[model samples]
Target: MVSSSSTPAAFVTGAANGIGEAVVARFLAGGYRVAMVDLDADRLRAAREKADPAGERTIEAVADVTDEQSVRAAISATVEAFGRLDAAHNNAGITSSGPNTHELELSAWQRTLDVDLTGVWLCMKHQLPVMLEQGSGAIVNTASIAGHIGYRNAAAYAAAKHGVVGLTKTAAIEYAPQGIRVNAVSPGPVQSDMLEASFERRGAAVRDWYYASSPTGRFASLEDIAHAVHWLASAEASFITGHCLSVDGGWIAQ
Candidate 1:
């Protein structure tokens, strides 16, 4: 059930920056036709241009994963552009903080779930049908350290990511018979623009703590998380499915 085409294609959400952006480059380097989706049209276009200045093998999709119609259209566009859909990365998500579950606002909770958990579902909702039709495909969801364990103030984000982990496993099981593999990548601490801003807000002390906590003594580079994701979609990981691969540099072990 491997792709017959010499060059396969991939659809990646949250592709404007961070790990998503890194994955876009990774797939391109692997000789893939990539459709990069992000909510930020400008940033996404910039990424698309930087990734493929010649306007070949890359499509910029400005779509929101949280909206069902938007998600469907984006997938459709990807297929139209690439002639087939072989892989997907449900990587778009938002971070939300609540003092605690009790104090968490209903709206905040709902939005977090909508973007992080339900968004992945929607992407699968649309992408699975295409993969099912093609009879083969792969998908990777970006879960987090919060999904595997507790992070005190991030109840809402944790809940949503945990849901993503469950969803990934469910899809993997259901689609195994049809040659589709669904998996997740959970990262503990990564180097991204978001982390920089978060640390700036949380102060140097907290930032330093995250670095020292990593057994490797530093935050994960964007490529660290991206490479794991790229592997899951490649032939090397053909036997791996429904698995939550932890690229946490031993943070999970601690």
Candidate 2:
């Protein structure tokens, strides 16, 4: 329930596909200006074509979330395009290198941490200044259910996501006094390209095993996660911070 006068601009990373794309669409539909950032230029363009046909207030930036220079430039571009940044969804991240933690290469582990954990830090590093200047803002980070619990072969991903939740909580408290809120959204198995790729690699039986374990007997949808993020960034959540909102279809309840 953000005030109409403060319908602020938003920046969303990893917006080329899946949940990121859905978040962009939801924000745009709510009449908020948005800047979408992704490493894949072609995919970003396609997402724009599908989500922001009018192109009235949508800005697209091709950048790597792991690269500080790219991220800084993208944030700068967002501010230049929209005048100010009032909200951000730091959703850009990569999966673990492989299924087996012990066998995973150091490079792979490092890459996951770089994108999933450090990337959020970099976004916050730049975003905080803008938000502080405005004296009001909200940030919703994309963590995973793995953040709270371990998965069999996803040690690196789980560790990195756990870091995200910790960072979100600390930042939330540090900035709450300044009228800035930071929160994390932990999604369970969601029906996204990420999950589809994992299914293709691991087979339907394995994927079905996960779905069956969920209390809801199903995976969450992109829109399901998007709705949660939208709520976290809205003014209705003004009193909420240092919170990890789970949109995991009862996966954690079990």
Candidate 3:
């Protein structure tokens, strides 16, 4: 085991980069042993190394959230390493390409749901069991402002995120009596490679539109979203459950 039973341990998916990476840092900084999971094995190791150069407080789990067996094994591995699971951030997801509903292929829709919606469920399927066995745990899933509102060209992405919100609420209720709390963080435009790529593909006009829509007039940094995830999974938010906190820089308020 990596640490004493008194030390908290956390599992985070999509942890190789972006928001997930930042969340791992937050957890580690808070003195939690962390399992950094991602599909990209190399990046995951590098991330773990960067966050814990002494290799004392973190482990890297290469996992595909869409694969049940992979997710199960990763969770098991984390428990084996850390001795217990106290929190989980189911953050592995991908955004759909901007294709109108009429232009979107069926495969694209299925792919988005597989990674964004079904993936979250699979992680929780395995994670919840561990948390239940431990008698307490916190889970924070990554949602989006799009989950709360319809986006013009992202039908599948929006639908999948909407499903995430529903799942968060239902799971929170079902698991609350078991001493587990489930919630979600809905981020708007966050500064990351993914958003930058979208801007590259769509040009300045779309980017300007995003800026204008946000009351902050700017995108959120990865740390902004990470902070929300960390707080939602912490003891500070003990009374909050079945809630979807928006870290959107005031985008949805408009």
Tell me the spans in candidate 3 whose CA falls farther than 4 Å from its real position.
1-4
- Tens digits of per-residue lDDT, candidate 3, 112-202, equal 9999999999999999988888788999999999899988899999999999999999999999999999999999999999899888998
* Every model's TM-score: 0.96, 0.96, 0.97
Query: Considering only N, C-alpha and C atoms within 3 Å, which residue pairs clash in candidate 3?
Result: none
Clashing pairs in 2: none
The candidate that achieves the highest TM-score relative to the unseen native structure: 3
Q: lDDT for model 1, please.
A: 0.91
Residue 98 displacement in candidate 1 (angstroms): 4.9
**After superposing candidate 1, which stretches have Cα over 4 Å from the reference?**
1-5
Which tens-of-lDDT digit does each residue in 1-254 have in candidate 1? 32346579999999999999999999999889999999999999999999999998899989998899999999888887777888899999887763777999889999999999999999999999888888889999999988999887789999999999999999999999999999999988888888888777778988888888899887889999889999999889999999998888899798
Minimal lDDT window, size 10, model 1: 1-10
Q: Write the per-residue lDDT of candidate 2 for residues 47-126, one digit (tens) a residue.
A: 98888787887999998888899999999998887778888999999876355877888888888899999999999999
For model 1, which pairs clash?
none
Q: Over the full model, what C-alpha lDDT does candidate 2 score relative to the true structure?
A: 0.90
lDDT per model vs. reference? 0.91, 0.90, 0.93
Give the per-residue Cα lDDT of candidate 1 at 64.
Answer: 90
